[model samples]
Target: MAGSRVLFFEHTLSIKGFDKALEALDWMKEEMCKEKGFSRHDGGDYYDHLVATAQDLLDVGIKDEDIIIACLLHDSVEDVEGITVKMVAGRFGENVAHMVDLVTKKPGVDYKVGDNLKRYLEAISKHPGASLIKTADRIHNFGTLKNATPEKKLRQALETEKYFIPFFKTCRGAHPRYAKYFFRAKTTIEPHLWEIKEHYEEIEQLRDQLRKQERTA
Candidate 1:
C-alpha cells in the first residue's frame, strides 16, 4: 500500500519535474500528519481521497499525468495542514498550485453555510480539475458519514443531493472519460443517503415524542 501510494505520488510529481514534486510531496506528507481530518492508517486524508478519485480516472483511461497529479494535490493546499497555494506553486509550479487553488475554500468568509456550499459547487462546475477533486472529497465524506452526529449526517446528505450530485453530473458531461466512475459513485451513495435521511427523521420523531411525554407528565 505504501508503495502504491509512493507510485501515485511519483506519477503526479512527474508532470511538474521529479525532484521539485518530490519536495512538495514530502512537505505534503508532513502536512497530512498535522491536519485534523487525516486518518493515519486508512488513508482518509483529503489527499488520499483525491488519490482514490485519480485512481478511478486512471482506470477509465484518462492518462494525463498533470490531471492525475492535479487530482492528487487538489486539496493539499486548500485543506491540508498549514500549506498554501503559493507554497505549492513555488515548489511544484503554477499549474499544480492553480488546480489546488481552484478547489480551496477561503477561510472565515462569513457567509452562511448554505451560501458557502453553493459558491463551492459553482466553483467546481467552472473547473474540471476542481470538480474531480470535489467529487472525490464528497465520496470520502459520504463514506465517513456514519461517524457523524445525526444532525450532521442529515445536513451532509442534503448537501450532497442538492449541490454535489448536479455538479458531478456536469463534470461527467464535460469529461466523458470519468462519466462511468462518477455515475457509479453516485449510484452507490444515493442509497446510503436515503438510509441516513430516514435515520435522522426517526431520531427527530423520538425526540419529539419524548418532549410531548414530558409535557404531559
Candidate 2:
C-alpha cells in the first residue's frame, strides 16, 4: 500500500524534469521549515501542500525551473518574517524571486481579508505565472477543506467558488488539458461544502430547540 501510494505520487511529479522538480521540493521542505507556518499551518504538512502545488505546476507543463522553484517558495516571503523578495532573489536568482514576488501578498496593506483576496483575483491578470501557482494553491486548499472548521469551510468554499473558480477557468484557457483535471477533482468539494452548510443549519435548529426548552423550564 505504501509503495503504491508512493508510485501514485511519483507518477504525478514525473511530468518532465522530474529530478529538478523533486530537488526543488526538497529545497522547499528545508526552507519552509524556517517559516513559522511550517509546523503551525492549520493543514498539517504545509510543506507537503506546496509540494503538491509544485507537482500540479509540473503536471501543467510548467517546465521553467524558475517558475517551479517559485511555486515551491510561493508562501515563504509572505509567511516568513525577514524573508523578503530581495532575499529570495539573492539566493534563488531574480527570475525565481520575481515569480514569488508576483504571488506574495504585500504586507502592511490594510486590506481586509476579503479585500486582500480580491486583490489576488484582480492581480492575476497582470501576472500569469503567479496565477498558475495561485490556482494550484487554491485547488489544494478547497480540496482538503474538510479539515477546516465548518464556518471556515463555508467561508473559504464560497470565496473559492466565487473568485478562485474563475481563476481556474482563466488558467484552463491557457493550459486546457491539465486544468480540466483540476476542476474535475474539485467536484467532490461541492458536496463537502453542502455537508458543512447542513451542519450549520442543524446546529441552529438544535440551538433553537434548546432555547425553547429553557424557556419552558
Candidate 3:
C-alpha cells in the first residue's frame, strides 16, 4: 500500500469502533482536501500521527478507550472549520467529544498565536488526555519545521525547547504511560531545536559585531 493509504488504514484500525471513526475520518479528509496550503494538509495528517501515538500509549499500558479516541480526534475540531465537539459528540458519543472540546481553542479569540498557545497549554494542564494529544500534535509539528523559513524555524525551536519541553515534563508526571513517546518525539526533534538555537546565537553575535564596528567607525 502507498504510505499515506497505509497511514490511513493504520489510523482506522486504532479507533475503538473502526467503522464509525472511519466515517468521521473520511469526512475530515474530504473537508481538508478542499483547502489550500501545506499547513492544512499537515493538520489533516495529524489523524495518522495521533493513531500512531495512540498505539504508543497502548504499548505503555494506557487502556482507556476514551483517551485513545481523544488522541485521534483531538485536533479535528480545532483544525477543521465547521467541525465541532458537539458534532463529534452527536456522531461519536460524549466522552470522546468532551475530551476534544477541552483541547479545542475557541474560534476567533484574537489573541496572538503565542497567547493562544499559552491558553492551550493551560487547558492541557487540567486534563491528562488533552495533554497527551497536545504532546502528539507538537511532536508532529516540530518534526516538520524544516519546511519553514530559518527565522520562523528558529523561533519555533526556541518555543519548543523553552515552553513545550517543560510542559511535556509536567505531562510525564501525570501520564507516565505517555512519557516515553513524548520523550522520544522530543529527542527526535532536538537536533532541529539545537540547530535553530545555534543559528540564533550566530546571528546575535554577528549583530553585536556590526554594532561594535559602527562604534569604532
Cα-based lDDT for every prediction: 0.69, 0.69, 0.68
lDDT of 2 by residue, 110-202 (tens): 444777777766676355677677777777777776556667777876777666666666666765545655465457456765676787789
Per-residue lDDT of 1-217 in model 1, one digit per residue for the tens?
6558767656755654645445545555666642655663445544455556666655656655556666667667656666788877776678777777877777877434778878767776676666666676677668866566777778888878887787778778886766876787688789998898888788889999999999999
Q: Which sections of candidate 1 miss by over 4 Å?
A: 1-24, 34-53, 80-82, 110-112
Candidate 3 residues 1-217, lDDT tens each?
2246536555645554555655655554455443533132334444455555555555556666677667767767877777788898988899788788877777777434777777767778667777776776777667766666776787778788877887777777776766786677678778878877988899999999999999999
> Which of the predicted structures, 2 or 3, would earn the higher TM-score when compared with the native?
3
As a whole number from 0 to 100, the lDDT of residue 215 in candidate 2 is: 100
Q: Which ten residues in a row have the lowest lDDT in candidate 2?
A: 1-10
- lDDT, model 3: 0.68
What are the models' TM-scores? 0.76, 0.74, 0.75
